[model samples]
Target: MSSQVIENHRANAEIYSGAPICIEKSRQLLDEISMPKGLLPLDDLVEVGYNRAAGFVWLRQSKSKQHRFNRIGKTVSYDKEVTAFVENRRMKKLTGVKSKELLIWVTISEIFIDESNPDSITFASSTGISRTFPVSAFELEEDGKK
Candidate 1:
């Protein structure tokens, strides 16, 4: 998101700065929204913020990063700043994220878990294409996390 937008969001928003707290806040937001804790996997996070009333969240990092999820064998890219509107069991209107498929890098627009399919998560691209994967695949087995 642009600096103007971020500045506006900072008003009454719950904001965390620095890697340690930013990582913790990022993971907590995922957990709160029913997403796998490691779904983001951003590096060197500089700030994390959430405006509850607007249901907006943003994460800023030192630089862009490309991560290959070994479990899914797919490369995903995270831009310097990421933003989304989050709700329980869902995240929509996502920006600054993309996933590679074959030779194309598709923009991911939404991610959600169906109430009827509790074990899986679906990622929808801006092109309206989507794919489902096991929720466990994105889970991070980190210390102090069950």
Candidate 2:
């Protein structure tokens, strides 16, 4: 193959393997979860992988735990920041704007972290409405109730 062809092949392989594909799949899953009737029990999900052999995605609860759930059809559109916010919330990881799942259809306009209580996060909706959530409910990775 020519040098340009070899470079293109490597680029495509990179896009289809490892972190990039996993992150994109995670983002797609989060977008699906943001829609109505899109309740995904993600508190137990640690890693998600796309199965090229089976033509499906698999979600792993932990290093030694696994389970399967059916897929949903709806998807919600979100900006990059909101997508990262949702991903962090699903992973129960702390970010600058810590929060939990709020309204499904509304877009988040602003995030406010309560200094008095690091456990609380306030979110302003795109429609000018605000809501707060307690991060205490989601601080643990194994709080699988959702």
Candidate 3:
């Protein structure tokens, strides 16, 4: 895919409701969307959104233009920047009403539950952050979450 193709896709989506875009529109689309030069810097990922129900991840560059991709349940392919971004956003700070921490926008495999203790779960982020928590402490909510 060429820069022209990406521009065209962006234009086309803008004409519509900006509904989620598929990562595999075609092989050509994938080639075009991939980082042209090198890795996609973490700072370049301006806004990352996930939809758990639809299993879609929306990525926007710093300029606010957005693109969506089908999320793989296992390790993310292509770039670690996205994986890191997703991991960071997945960790939710403990709130007053909620005793357990909520993990938003994560795949089942990305989290592990201790068989010996159903209440205990282990989480590790792409950046190497890991922790264990109670199952009740985490929730998966994915609706326009960044």
Q: Where does model 2 exceed 4 Å of error? A: 1-17, 20-104, 143-146
Ranking by lDDT: 1, 2, 3
Q: Write the per-residue lDDT of candidate 3 for residues 1-146, one digit (tens) a residue.
A: 22332343343242211223222221112123221111121234433344333233334433322222222122222222122112222322211111112544332223344456655655654444555654433222232242
lDDT of 3 at 97: 11
Model 1 residue 34 CA deviation in Å: 1.2
TM-scores for the candidates: 0.93, 0.31, 0.23
lDDT of 2 by residue, 1-146 (tens): 12232233332232233444454555465445331112233333444443332223333332221112222122323211211223222322111122223444554545444557665655566556666655443222343346
Which stretches of model 1 miss by more than 4 angstroms? Answer: 143-146
Name the best candidate (by lDDT): 1
Q: In candidate 1, which residue pairs get closer than 3 Å at backbone N, Cα or C atoms, i.e. clash?
A: none
CA lDDT, every prediction? Answer: 0.90, 0.36, 0.30
Give candidate 3 regions above 4 Å deviation: 1-81, 84-110, 124-130, 140-146
- lDDT per residue for candidate 1 within 30-81, as digits (tens), equals 9999888889998599999999999989999999999888888989999998
Q: Per-residue lDDT for 117 in model 1?
A: 98
